[model samples]
Structure formats: structure tokens, C-alpha cells
Target: MGPLIPQEIISLDWNLVIAFVVGIGFGFVLEASGFSSSRKLAGIFYGYDTVVLKVFFTAAITAMLGLLYLSLFGWIDLNLVYVNPTYLWSAIIGGIIMGLGFIIGGFCPGTSVCAAAIGKIDAMVFIIGIIIGIFIFGEGFPIWKEFHEAGNLGSLKIQDIIGISGGLFTFLIIIFAMILFKTGEWAESQFTREEY
Candidate 1:
């Protein structure tokens, strides 16, 4: 809601309320999708289950298509949508750490919270680790401030970066997703786990 208040449709006051409602809805969806199970959420890395990939890929495609269609129909203004500025070094390092944490702990931050809400011990421990990490980062912010701010590339869209239209980019992504889906299916069959 920080940047969204400037947009046409939603106002400042309702932003927090909308965010709270959407967050709850998102958590419910995650729980319903079996993301509350650490094994299920971690299965993507082991190749036994591909539900995580399928769900996330579907979500990305749906959101992209929804926004594109909404813009076309004048239901939403794409120009008004906020894009976060890229801090390349920070992003690369953060992604690596996050990925490692996800693989080792069997829960990403959001999924950990979702699982913890439903009384998962592992997820609770993971959340505690996350809090510790956050505290460390906050306390050591000054020391790593330069590295965190390094490689500023401004806000970028994939379509803009690749010199293609947004629609064409989305189409290519959809095709890639189809291929990935098939690959995920293959992986699941090849790496079937009895526990999963």
C-alpha cells in the first residue's frame, strides 16, 4: 500500500484493510494447497512432487493474463502499477540465501508462517530463525549497506529488457511454463518417493 495509494482506484485509508483481507485470503489459499506441509512444500527441490512449481507457475500466468486483460478492458491502469527498483547484488545474494534456507528448512518465509499458523513445530522453529536473521540484518545494516545498494538497475520489466511486447513476452512465458510442467511431471515419475 505504500506506493499503491497514489493509484486511482484504491485510497490510502482502505489500503491496509484491503491488504489485511488479501493476506488472509492468500494464507487460506496456501493452506488449502497443502503448502502447510513442509514435505509437500520441499518436494519441488527433491523432484518427488511438482505441485509447488505448478501452483506458482499457474499463479504467475494467471496474474499476468489478468492484469493484461484488465488493462485492455480499461478496468485497471498498468501505468499506475508500482514496480520495485532493482538492486541486483542484493537480490542475487538474497535469493541464494533464501533458496538455501528453503531447501534446508523445508519452508520459505511465507509458507513457514502459513504452516506455523496451523501449528507446525518445524515451521515455528523456521520462523524463529527468520526473526534472528532479520534482527542480525537490521543490526548489521550499516556494515553491509554498500553491498546492499550496489548494482542499481532501476525498475525493469522483462518485456522491456528483452525488447519485446508485453503480450509476446507473456506468450513465451506461457509456452515455457507448459514445457516446465511436462518436465516436472517427468521428474515426479522418475523420482517418486514412498513418503511423499
Candidate 2:
């Protein structure tokens, strides 16, 4: 009954339109939340400002709970939802590279774009670096193709892997997030930054 496009409730023609609208909405929210500021975004790593962690954690939990409820009520077909196939080696290497980039540049791809849109010079430079990185990766794809495709674990969810019900997994995640939130609050108090 859901996964609108997969169910044919929404036609393919509207996919890009929906995505564009959602992207704009997301960018607007990021800006409003002060995520456009590199300092604010980077504070998550420094343990000063936890708004980034709090906002993202809330979003994850909200989405998880929303999907759970929707599936429970038969409003959505959970099976129709897409799960990205896992590429183990590529994921690990990419995560490390991106983590370093985030720490150094103070912006992930999304936040960089959001800040760039608002005329941030640093974000603009970050976007240029991102483009250069992409160009290099594309041009050298043949060299890393084998490594990228080496660890092909098919789409797997935590609940399926751990032999638990989705609801139980969601509950666990909620508890974990609550603990993180408290930790983040404490960290902010301990690591208070005069500039931020």
C-alpha cells in the first residue's frame, strides 16, 4: 500500500520532482537548525555543540518509529522499501576517508551544499574539493573496481542479522539514542566552547 513509486501509486515522472522538493525542505531545515555553520556542524566531533548529534539522532528515531507504526497499521509495505546492498571493504574505506574529510573540512556533503547555497566561502571551497574528489574517483574507477566489488554482502538489516523482530530492534535503538543524548548533554557542559 506504500512505497508510492514501487506500488505505482506515484508515477516515475514525479520522482525527480518529489526529490527536489524534499531536498529543498531538507536544506531549509539544516539552515534553520544552524547546521549551515561549519563550527556548529564540527562541534559534534569536538564534543562542544551536540545539536548536530541530537538533531540527527532524533531524525533517525522518528523515521524508525514512523516506519514501524506505518507497517503495523498496514499503511506501508515494508518489503517494498529499498535497502542498499552492502559492499564491505568499500564501505569501510569510504567511511574512513569521509570521516577524515568531515573532521578537517567541517562539512559533510549535504551540509556543504546547504552552506554553499547560503554563500559560505568555505563551503563553496569544500564543494569544489568534493567535485575534484568525485572526478578523480570516476577517472580512476577501473583501478579500484575490483576492491569496490570485492565484499558483496546482499541487502541485510540489523534485525534479520541478529534474529530479532524489527519492533524489538527499534526499541533497542531508541534506548541507545536516549543514552547518547544524555552523554551528549554532559559532554556539552564539560567541553563548553567560548566561541560557540
Candidate 3:
């Protein structure tokens, strides 16, 4: 009954409009929460600030719980949700590259875009680099197509891989998030700094 777009309850044009509105809202929230500051975003790694971790974990857990409730109430069909197919090697390589980029640039692609929107020169440069990287990746895709497709794991859910029910997996994730949040609080206290 829900998943309005896929179910045709909402028209395609309306879906696009909704998506744009949501994106703007999300960006506003991110900027308002200081995600526009590379220093603030990087603080997660330095242990000086744990706001990033807290916000990320809170959002993730909230979404998971919301989806669970939605499914339970028959407002959405979990089975209708799309999951990306796993390309093991490419995923690992991409993740490593992304991690390095995060450490060095102090901003992920999303935050960089948000910062760029607000006139951050560094973020603008980062975005240019991202566009170039995308171009290179697209150009080289054909050359590495085999390796990219090597790990042909079809769309698989974490619960399936871990041999647990979705509900149980979500519960465990929530618990893990809570533990990490507590740890983050401790880290922030220990690493508190006079500036940033």
C-alpha cells in the first residue's frame, strides 16, 4: 500500500519532486548540524567530537526501526525494497579508496557537496576531484569489467548472510550502536580539546 512510487500510488513526476524536497531537507539538516565544517566532520576520526558518530548511529537505528514498524503495520513491504548486488572486490577497493578520501579530505561526497553549496573552497575542489574520479572510473570500467563482475553475489541481505532473522539482526545492530555511542561519549570526554 505504501512505497508510493513503485506501487504507482504516486506519479513519477510527484516522486521526483518529493525526492528533491527530501534531499534539500536532508542537506539543510546536515549543514545545520555542522556537517558543513570539514573540521567537525573530521573530528570523528580525531576523537575530539563524537557528534558525527552519534548522529549517524541514531539516524541508522531510527530508519531500521521505522522500516520494521512500517512493515509490521503493512504500510510497506520489506520484500519490495531493493538491495544492491554485491561486487566483492570492487566493493572492498571502493571502500578503501573512500576511507582514504575521508581521512585526507575530511569530508565524504555528500558532506562535501553540502559544504560546496555554502561556498567552501575546499569542498568545491573535492567535488571537482570526485567528478574526475567518476570520469576515470567510467572510462576504465570496460577494462576492469571482468574484475568488477568477478564476485557475482546477487542481492543478499545481511541477515541472510549472518544466519539470523531480520528482526534479530536489527536488534543486534541497535545494541551495537548503543555500545558504540557510549564508547564515543567516553572518547569525547578523554579527547576534549580547547579548539575544534
Candidate 4:
């Protein structure tokens, strides 16, 4: 009864419009929250400011809870939802590369694009680097295709993997997030920096 796009309740064109609007809103929020600053992003790694961790945890938990509630209420069909297939080795390699990029460049792809939009020279350079990296990846896909396709685990959910209900897994995630939030607060106090 939900997932308007897949259900054809909303046309493809309108879905794209909605996506654009959401993207704009998200970018505005990020910029307003000082995510446009590379220093602010890098602060997470240095234990100076953990706003990134807090915000991310909040968003993830909120989304998970919201989806769970929606499905329970029959507003969304959880079975109709798509899950990305797990490619273990590629996923790990990709995450490691992305983590290194975030640590060194001080911005993930999304924040880098938002910062670049606001005329940040460093972010602009980072975006260019991203483009170059993507191009290289595209060109070398054949060479790494086998490795990328390795460890093919079909679409699996955390709840299924752990043999728990979605509700229980989400509740546990909330608890974990709470712990991280407390740790982040402590880290912020310990690594306060006046510059950024």
C-alpha cells in the first residue's frame, strides 16, 4: 500500500522531483549544521568535535525506527523494499578507501559536494579527485570485476543474519547509539579546540 513510486502511486517524473527536493533539503541542513567545514568533519577523527558521529547515529536510528513503524502500521510494505546484495570483499575494500578519503580530505562525498557548491576550494579539489577516481574505477572495472563479484551473499538483512526480529535489532541499535553518544560527548570535552 506504500512505497508510492514502486506501487505506481507516484509517477516516475514526480519521484525524481521529490528526490531533487529531498536532496536540496538535506544539503541545506548539512550546510546549516556546519558540515560544510572540512575542519568540523575532521574533528570527528581527532576527537575534537563528534557532531558527525552524533548526527549520523541519530539519522540512522531515526530512519530505521521510522521504517519499522511504517511497516508495522501497514503504511509501507517491508517486503517490497530493496536491499543491496552483500559483496563482502568489495564492500570492505570500498569502505576502507572511503574511510581513508574522509580522514585525509576531511569530507565524505556528500559533504564534499555540498562544500564545493558553497565555493570551497579544497572541496572542489576533492570533488575533482573523486571524479578522477571514478573514471579510473570505470576503466579498470574489468580487471577487478572478479574480485568485486566475490563473496556474493544475496540480499540479507541484519535481523535475519542475527536471527532476531527487526524490532529487537533496532532496539539494540538504539542502545548502541546511546552508548556512542555518551562516548562522543566525553571525547568532545577532552579534545576541545578553539580553532574549529
TM-score of each: 0.95, 0.98, 0.95, 0.98
Q: Give the per-residue lDDT of model 2 (tens digit) for 1-196.
A: 8989999999989999999999999999999988989999889898999998889889999999999999999999999999999999999999999999998999999999999998999999999999999999999999999999999999989899999999999999999999999999999999999996
User: Which of 2 and 3 is ahead in lDDT?
Assistant: 2
Q: Candidate 4 — which residues are off by over 4 angstroms?
A: none
- Per-candidate local distance difference test: 0.91, 0.94, 0.90, 0.94
In the predicted model 3, the residue pairs found to clash are none
| Collision pairs in model 2 | none
Writing each residue's lDDT as its tens digit, candidate 3 over 1-196 gives: 8777778888878977897999999999999999999999888888988899999889988988998899999999887777799988989988999989998998999999999999999999999999999999899999989988988798988899889987899999999999998998899899898886
| Superposition TM-score, candidate 2 onto the true structure | 0.98
Ranked by TM-score, top first: 2, 4, 3, 1
Q: Show where candidate 3 strays beyond 4 Å.
A: none
Q: Report each candidate's C-alpha RMSD, comma-separated, in the order given.
A: 2.2, 0.8, 1.2, 0.9
State the displacement of the C-alpha of residue 2, model 3, in Å, after optimal TM-score superposition: 1.7
Better of 1 and 4 by TM-score: 4
Clashes of 1: 0
lDDT ranking from best to worst?
2, 4, 1, 3
Better of 1 and 2 by TM-score: 2
